[model samples]
Target chain A: MSITREEVLKMAELARLEFSEEELDGFTAQFQGILDYIEQLRQVDVEGVEPTSHVSLSADFDPRMFREDEARESLPVEEALGGAPDPAAGHFRVPKVL
Target chain B: MSLRRIEEADPALGAFLTCDPGRVLERAERVDRDVKERPLPLAGVPVAVKDNICTRGLRTTCGSRMLEQYVPPYSATAIERLEAAGAVVVGKVNCDEFAMGSSTENSALQVTRNPYDLDRVPGGSSGGSAVAVAAGMAALALGSETGGSVRQPASFCNVVGLKPTYGRISRYGLVAFASSLDCIAPLGNSPRDIALLLGRIAGRDPLDSTSAPAPVPDYVAELDRPPGRLRLGVPKEYFGQGLDPEVKAAVEAGIRNAGKLGCDVVEVSLPHTRFAIADYYIIAPAEASSNLARYDGVKYGFRAEAPEDLMDMYRRTRTLGFGPEVRRRIMIGTYALSSGYYDAYYGRAMKVRTLIRRDYERAFEKVDALLGPVSPTAAFRIGEKASDPLSMYLSDIYTVTANLAGIPAVSVPCGFTAGGLPIGMQILGNLFQELPLLRLAQAYIREFPVAPPPLRV
Candidate 1:
């Protein structure tokens, strides 16, 4: 029935987004508004209408069709590695063996 | 370089979790050099990718620190198709950590703000991608919609977001959100661009068996054909609850406009619509928890800052890397799939998911497409609903059904609020029926002019 800033902060931390004290106030108010809004859904009386989950029958929506069975030419070693902040010998080079 | 535009506009807009100026300009330069005789339709177009998609050398972080430094060894099939089509990679945009949240606020990397208002959120888990395109950082972008992740953001950001029919596009290498529920979608300035992008990416792919073998229609061709006499279903369930009065007005406007285009608007009810969100959470998380188990630190991705041993590494890495929402869903999913709970939780949820699909099947039988507000409300100010997770979940109220049903849906900006925030109208069609969706979108776009900019840069 009630939402709290502590929960919001906890949720924000869980979500990995940082909010300054100034911004936390903003999010808390918005979350309340949104929660209050969602309350409207509680008003709909769907006593007999079954809850629907999946909409399309594509469940067996196979992923293999998007699969690449054969290895094809990829971007050049240099081209592919071109964006890495740290790269060595066409492979990404990072801190240590650990 | 386009980096400045985003950097200048993005900090407050929250369009990216990571933006490397040096790398983007370099990619832009390379894209310039690669422009050859091939008239790639989207050549030189900078694209922001949802973090969940594999981008080979990029961090491909999925907005989670668990893989903050992780980079895939291979490219996603959709990304491969885009690059082959000459689309330039701008950067990996933000998302709900592990594609869990409806607002980009769930992003472990950054809180992606909506372009419509700095204070309001851009919808997620594809929120950052939608923001990037709406703010013009990218001419186009790629997003993944398990529920309404892509379309909701597109609606909030005032752009075209398309969740094509399940398998219309390959999911190969898209970091699994909910494998069965997730579909890589297109977010762009307009519907034509989505059609163009879909053409290149759709069709059978060996890498993903779910990729549809159905012929990818020439969406542009359908756009030219008259959309006259088409049955447009307006489901009454979506009009209820949490929907902003202004957004509902906009949906009505969109309907009247389509009516002007000669499409017959009909009142069609998918009676089971209310259960969409509940059924979706159960299934998406059930699948996601199983998918996320793969991210244990020892195998790949982020490791704990200090780990005494392998087990310690898994626990610490996950505990530290995953944000709370991700953990919550993981826990929910774990509980749902656990030994004693599987039948009650996962099993029942799957059956409910089937019923949800059946609802759409029944509705589609009488209508060519369904329409409604993409989200219940227009852009809500940032930090608005982070506290109340229940309220935040409602953001996907209109979108989750499409994913649950495995159909095609597109969000097209129809009107703006009194405050000037965007209101997106959602149009959904049956499985493998992407062309009609695009046609309906294009017809609306012809009246709206939100497509690619009239003046080329």
Candidate 2:
């Protein structure tokens, strides 16, 4: 019915995240609150009503999609790094590892 | 200079986390030179882009340290179009990290304050964009909506936010939140401005495969069309429980204002509104967790220093990089997708999602358009729900269904709470019905434009 700390741990494992002690305590309470709110749905009789997915129910026309199958524009190496915080001759530079 | 004004003002205003003052001013000058003889429509307009959009020369942080220094190599298609239309990029505005929350309060970078009241929060994801435009820092802004990111913030900030029907605007360069549910939209101080900007941006794009081939309607001209037979639907679900009395009253007043302009208002029930939030959590996260898997510090983003192995690098980088909300959704998504839980979670949610769409279908048959509150409450104080995640997620209750349905929706300033904080009434049109929605919003603005949003320090 509601999210449990165990559920949070299970979720964290599935998500591959490691939480701090503070975070674990904080999120458990938070996620539980959301689950409780969603439980409000259980009160409504949505059994017979068709569930709504999109604002528009029409499923008529689908757009025609196609691509040239070619790389149209490839920026030169210099232009590619123009936005990088730190850039070398042709590539982005990161902090030294070894 | 105007550039300094935004940075200087936005810091306290919380509109911009990073202001590219030098670049924005320089780019404005380039617009002058590059477009001298032939003036572009948006020539010289300084615009703020939500951090989630990738701008080629600026760091595309998406309000997270995960992309703290990641400057995208190429411009997002929307940004490219805006620049081509002669708008200079002022800088990136802060947002809910990865646009996962309703209140911009979720952004780890900096929370954008509502221009109306400094202590109150701006609505999320596109909060900074709305604040930037509302505060006069920029004439226009770019925001994306998976749910209410664009519209809700625009309501809080009293700007106009337009989320075109899915694929009305190219999604080629937006950082993905929920792919099927997301869109790059426009925000402006007024409905007319939204129409003008939409004219320049909406259309088929070769790069975005999802873009519809339908001719991009001339939004500006369409704004003037008279409302002769406009049948607007008022969904009872949106105006119900948890909605502040002041906000509900304001929305009804807004409907009356629209009625005065010859728009016919009718009550329509989106019967499955009850199941939307539950359905959204399942579907959106399932999509997002999969989309975000690329950020494992392997291909092109921040990587953490780990003890030896590749798993260590992936684990440490993701653990350190993403914020709590981002991690939460990713986990919810992953669990829903895991082998054992896939059918119960992801599969069932997909069925519900389909049913939710059907609810809208049935409603639209009785009404031409739908109206509702963009958000349940007016702007809340900073940290109001920061500690309570469920309450925060509920903040998007009114706005999420449209995303699930993939329809065009817009949030325009309708009225204000007693405290003068703006409340927006949302307009949802059938898929690809952006032109009519803009027209209706414009009509409402013409009849009763809320007073300019207060600019508090």
Candidate 3:
């Protein structure tokens, strides 16, 4: 259950998050403790057990519960982009992918 | 008057992120005008909203700098319903960043103190919501529960908090931490107020498919008919080690009071109770990791100043925007759902979750509801468990099971510690059974009422 600093950094990279050197050291220790604590779940004999990923979704999966997939008015572009950190020409402007 | 109280006391209490007097007055006036036409359930009731629930024009921060200035385009279904039913939203309150922590200390914006003891932490991430009601800043408040957010804070502040049956209330505008576990719950000074608010906000929302299509009952009317001669089970595991003696004693006394109401209080074992925290940690964070992936610097929210590329922007924006605990959860989730470890971690945890749910199902078949302590102990000092995340996580042990099982549960003021800290007794009900659950809460409150915490405010 031990997670090394490299593994921590790798996980951070996957999560699209970064950490400082000090934070990494501190979080790595805290993270390892949490992992170790949750590790107790391994002991449960889960043979033939159905994973309850969602309580309502798993038990009650009626398609009728959802709204009809009808096209309707959406938020106007101005309202939609009102909170955008960076917007340009009715689009969320990001750095060039190329 | 809630606005004036917020202005006067919220400075010291640190309960709100934003409280615009002009908007509050406008909404109140509108409610006043509307009540003339017909009776409203929550007519003119002042409510403080958690920052995570979207309010059309007001900023929805989720207590994270990532969304510090982010204003949503539309309000949540619950908010719209609250307004339509004549509830005046006092303001948006603070919470743990992305509703992650057990204490309000994780709020990047402000530290909300418990109304009972100013130096103690308001159990969170619904600390501000609880503080609002306890200090009379608002009559009721909306707090979202991913783990023990609302109820834990209510327990700390001596108010009442309800985590309704999952999908019993719509999650349309609630900022998702763990989609399956997140519930936009209510906190109030009394169970009667909670019932009133629940009636207004509970029902199917076309916008939120997860919202139950089940008929909404008159919760306030149901309260008139007390839950008579009920079978109340006291889970033995919740009473075991790590429970503070004072809390344990107080809750036992509360169970005894239930017996006075003709309830059959018996000991039951939720064998998988010990594994709840483990299962919850894995599942909640795994879902959180996915839900929060939308916060990349692309659309809205805080963006990094200068990035060489999109990848750099994503990493830097999240790194700078999220707090330490949030980053830790995201990392844990990423690692758990990672290629080589998914089955061992997330998969195993989900199966374990079934065991936890089954434990509740079996107990409910024998007893109408389960009574227990909401938190392991009363509110601790501000920095006591902040440094140790594991210790903080342990405090939520008694609360997470109800959420994991998707059942309704409420925290009512049971008693107080000698140190004058407030303790709460948690009552959990079967799926979609909020009516009887609330009746039990109302009956308990009617029989043994704990005076509201005497705050200097």
For residue B178, model 2's alpha carbon misses the true position, in angstroms, by 0.8
DockQ: the better of candidates 1 and 3:
3
Worst 10 residues of 3 chain B by lDDT: B448-457
lDDT of 2 by residue, B319-354 (tens): 888987888888778766878767566666666666
Worst 10 residues of 2 chain A by lDDT: A52-61
| Candidate numbers sorted by lDDT from highest down | 3, 2, 1
Best by DockQ: 3
lDDT of 3 at B300: 89
| TM-score order of candidates, top first | 3, 2, 1
Range of the 10 consecutive residues with the lowest summed lDDT in candidate 2 chain B:
B305-314
All candidates: CA RMSD (Å): 6.7, 3.4, 1.1
Per-residue CA lDDT of model 3 for B137-168, tens digit only, reads 99999999989899999999999999998998
Q: How close is candidate 1 to the true structure, as a TM-score?
A: 0.83
| Whole-model Cα lDDT of every candidate shown, in order | 0.76, 0.79, 0.91
**lDDT at residue B288 of model 3 (Cα atoms):** 92
Clashing pairs in 3: none
Q: Candidate 2 regions off by >4 Å?
A: A1-11, A20-29, A32-63, A71-98
B258-333 in candidate 1: lDDT tens per residue? 8888788889877767766766666787787778877655446765665565555556667677887776676556
For candidate 3, the docking band is high
